[model samples]
Target: HPWVGDHPLSPKSVIRDMYERALTFTELVSHYELARTEGIVLRYLASAYKALDHTVPDDLKSEDLQDLIEWLGEMVRQVDSSLLDEWEQLANPEEMTAEEAQEKADQVRPVTANARAFRVLVRNAMFRRVELAALDQVDELGEMDADAGWDADAWGEAMDGYWDEYDDLGTGPDARGPKLLIIEEEPQNALWRVRQIFDDPNDDHDWGISAEVDLTASDAEGRAVVRVTD
Candidate 1:
């Protein structure tokens, strides 16, 4: 009596109702497909990198010696040459020459904090998508060092591996490949589905505390076309 009178009914009902409605794989897939993305990846980073697309060079992760050099060259090309030269001067304990400091400041392109951070994220994503172990170790402070921070050899190897793997798979944007989309971006649809499931009194049978999960894959309007054998 105490438990019934004092205990909150909402939480208990929520949990119990979910327990009763054991949604099958078909239902899950249907829900996800209703709100799936049109492509394998989101276009946020791809859009950002589009500016460099023309000059970005065709980088299919590097494969051989030429590829490694090409990747390195791409990285260097994106950087203002004077920035590195100035860095060399400032790295030493000795005072930086006025010309060197001025050049560095002047050569500094308009890279906002957000842009820099996003580039780092894209780089990390590239490493991850390639299954490079080094991706896990890269950090914000470590990359800031410019010269001593990043290992060019390791990067080259990762680039090579990534491209090599891609080549073996024979995949490209135009290539025929399968893409599986997941997640229901719209909450309202999912919420409505859950409500319909929970509102059904037959979701959980009280006779023997048994649960009835919809296992059929048919697309019917109502329960009139369905039956339970158990």
Candidate 2:
């Protein structure tokens, strides 16, 4: 419990190493909470889709769950690339300068920062994806569980019980967290996704950008959120 401990840590005792760890709860909780919430919400969305017989809701004919997952992937990378992190970094942009930003302008960043930034990115992405995929315009901004008809408690339990592939993803499933969360054992969503490229090879028409691109206005056209119907 001491902010600054005087003793050194030994590996033999499980509790001994906890005291010397540098995280101090402050840095770790935010990231974990974000990942937990997003993970829970994603499972919730899956339950909703299942309830609807795996069909794209009439409101979502313009786009589907797959579109949203890809969108989340791009946002996760942006977070990793350090494009969005003031919330996780707890830094003030007015104080930060263009020159300093340039000096630290590597496309890649430390994983710790990326993990937390991803939470923020994915949280908003989940909300926006719903709207973009909706068949009709939604009246309200939030309050999705009640509107979209998801079993929140059941999905939350599923997330809590999730100890599969994600355990293998040391840093937590990278950018494809939503995709990773789905089950692949059956000839369903997951397997269908694996065969999408083969089903429509050279059919990159809908996805904003199937791969990475420069963060410029010219690339903006490719980065735009997509809507798929039929």
Candidate 3:
């Protein structure tokens, strides 16, 4: 199929279509295949962007290619940074012959492109709020009081038990605390745990907590909105 569908094949449309295709492939492919595919896609995207650069109206060109330009610039920066790091390591000569260093460098050098594309894909997915429910939370059980004589194993066991009971109790809104919308999912669990501690009536510890928790969410334009209540 043509990169751009029935729509007039303008430079902007072509670039946008290719980007969409690249993101789709990124999600579908394995890591090894992704690396090769990313290289090809990056080259295609670069060419498309170059074409757009010349053909786009002077008024709209900058705005049209802004994000794409940023991504390409970031890619170059990452590649350059990786090359510098490899060169510095080679200069240090850590018990390796010239051949070994070259081989190591070669293995690592191709990582930047794939890594960049994957990062872009993740960033875009997160911005678009894709599969928000599928994103895993990073549960942070705060450090236990050492004076209580709880060792690491004991603390772990206690946490496991707590979570087990928590799960058994249906993990409903009351049990899990109020739902708060955050930009990313990982921080949501940690924030929920903190809110629970803040709201616990049985807890005697003075946390100097606020009466209301301020949650954050993104607007349709991807702008941050604070003071969001459950």
Candidate 1 regions with alpha-carbon error over 4 angstroms: 1-117, 120-230
Give, for candidate 3, the lowest lDDT window spanning 10 residues. Answer: 129-138
Model 2 lDDT per residue over 2-48, tens place: 42133322222311121112111222235234333443333333333
lDDT of 3 by residue, 1-230 (tens): 34223333344654454343333434323422445445544445455544544556668855325555544433332333343334445557776777766665555333223433433433333222211111212121112123324344544554454444332222223222222212332334322111222212333322111111112222121211122121
TM-score of each: 0.16, 0.18, 0.27
Go through the candidates in order and give each one's C-alpha lDDT. Answer: 0.27, 0.29, 0.34
Q: For model 3, which pairs clash? A: none
Any runs in candidate 3 off by more than 4 Å, and if so which?
1-38, 62-64, 76-125, 130-230
RMSD to truth, every model? 27.5, 19.6, 16.4
Better of 1 and 2 by lDDT: 2
- Of 1 and 2, the candidate ranking higher by TM-score: 2
lDDT of 1 by residue, 160-230 (tens): 55434333321122111112111112233211110111111232311110111121211122111111111
lDDT of 1 at 15: 24
- Compute the lDDT for candidate 2: 0.29
Query: Of the candidates numbered 2 and 3, which has the greater TM-score value?
Result: 3
